[model samples]
Target chain A: MEKIPVLKIGNLLLISIQTDIYDSQGLQLQDDIANLLQRHSFRGVILDISSLSIVDSFMGKIINNIASISLVMGAETVVSGMQPAVAITLVELGLEMPNVKTTLSLEKAIQFFNEKFNRETDQDGSSQE
Target chain B: MEVLKSKTLKISEEKDLLNIRGLIREYAGEIGLPEIYKVKLLTATSEIARNVLKYAVSGRMTIRILSDIYKGIEVICEDNGKGIADVDSAMKKGFSTSGSLGLGLPGAKSLVHVFHIDSKLSVGTRVRLIVWRK
Candidate 1:
């Protein structure tokens, strides 16, 4: 049973799925992310799925669930690095993951969270302390 | 149709889904399936293969590269468990009995160029998925 590794950087967690994970593994990942979010004060989660060759309806649902769970735990989720072919297939497959936010690459995903948190900090005006 | 290449795989567990995807990718590439169609076929294959494990508990899949007037790949998945009771309803979106999103059958059909399903209660189900190089 291989577990997908989750790395923490700053206040965000990065989960780069590098293998063609099976159904159980995807479920395991959802559970792991939930547990991590419960234990940490992370503000965002970045999921990189560039290595995944296919995103079927099952996988699509898993990803969506991850994003939803993260949101409930007070963390935003950004999925990045989807291959062009996968993009086309996903839409054609009728799995519009409206709940998940997506970015084109890791840089964009990181930048997205950076700007978002910065804006939040500025709005609250508590980071000056 | 002419059979360019063919292989058989068993779908008894979750890991077999991965193997089905891998084998489909290989044959799709070898047959020069365009990137978009290749991805479509692969995704459809995964959906159907996973269905076998989820519902049937065990099954067999056959991959074939066929050429008649055009080149294409075909996958046939057969399961021995109790077949789908109402395939028409099963093909509808958001009609899942297993608490899933219920997009497996309909979504798989939408991805490929050709899709066929045959099932009988108390017998089994056979789904045929095909994508052509165009």
Candidate 2:
């Protein structure tokens, strides 16, 4: 019954997962993301997982699902602020969150998003002129 | 068995799997266990716990911290499910009946200092994992 809040910043959607999410909660999050895509004009999503201390394959798959769903909807997804422990465990398990872009921190992810957004906007602005 | 604290959790549904990882992290943090070892224990517990739920509808996990020469965590997950027919094949990566990433058993074993598994046909499966402070 836990609800994760998704914040809207400009053309970007931000989701910060703060706790260990259950199966139902993860699925609910995916639903929420899908709904948001329908309601807004989002160009990118940054999932902040700085507070999550555990990253099992099951959890990794959920994050990957979110990223893929977003990608299919024409939006870029980046997971930011992964702990060293989580990163090492993911590698050692012979598993990775497939198809999702990962960044070291939220700041870097936003910067990356901005650069991509700017290039596309600048090209669009000039192409019409 | 110089046990400092011991606890058991029931794993019956997918929702319950989260508890397994949370409990391991809590216990590891309480002991001030190193970050690497804590992640190891948490990851191992996650793999085994998921296997229990995937293979069996219900299972139990017993976790204990021992005060031996060095502090260590002992996790034993037991389930009365269909049981693994081929232990060796099951242990091999990419060999799964449920089509998991197929690294549960092998990955869990690699993360712990000690690993043991016993499965009987038409009976159940029991897996034990131990991680000591480094």
Q: Evaluate all candidate structures by whole-model CA lDDT and list the values in order.
A: 0.90, 0.86
lDDT of 2 by residue, A14-93 (tens): 99989877767878988999889878879898999999887877777778888888988989899999999888888888
Residue by residue across A16-48, what tens digits does model 1's lDDT show? Answer: 998788788889999999999999899899999
Each candidate structure's TM-score, on Cα atoms with residue i matched to residue i, is: 0.97, 0.91
All candidates: DockQ? 0.84, 0.56
User: What is the C-alpha lDDT profile of model 1 across B1-134, one tens digit per residue?
Assistant: 89999999999988788788888888988988998898888888888888888888999999999997889999999999899999999999999999998989999999998999999998999999989887
Q: Determine which window of 10 residues in candidate 1 chain A has minimal summed lDDT.
A: A120-129
Q: Any runs in candidate 2 off by more than 4 Å, and if so which?
A: B14-19
For candidate 1, the docking band is high
Count of backbone clashes for each model? 0, 0
* Candidate 2 TM-score to native: 0.91
Interface RMSD values, listed in order for every candidate: 0.9, 1.6
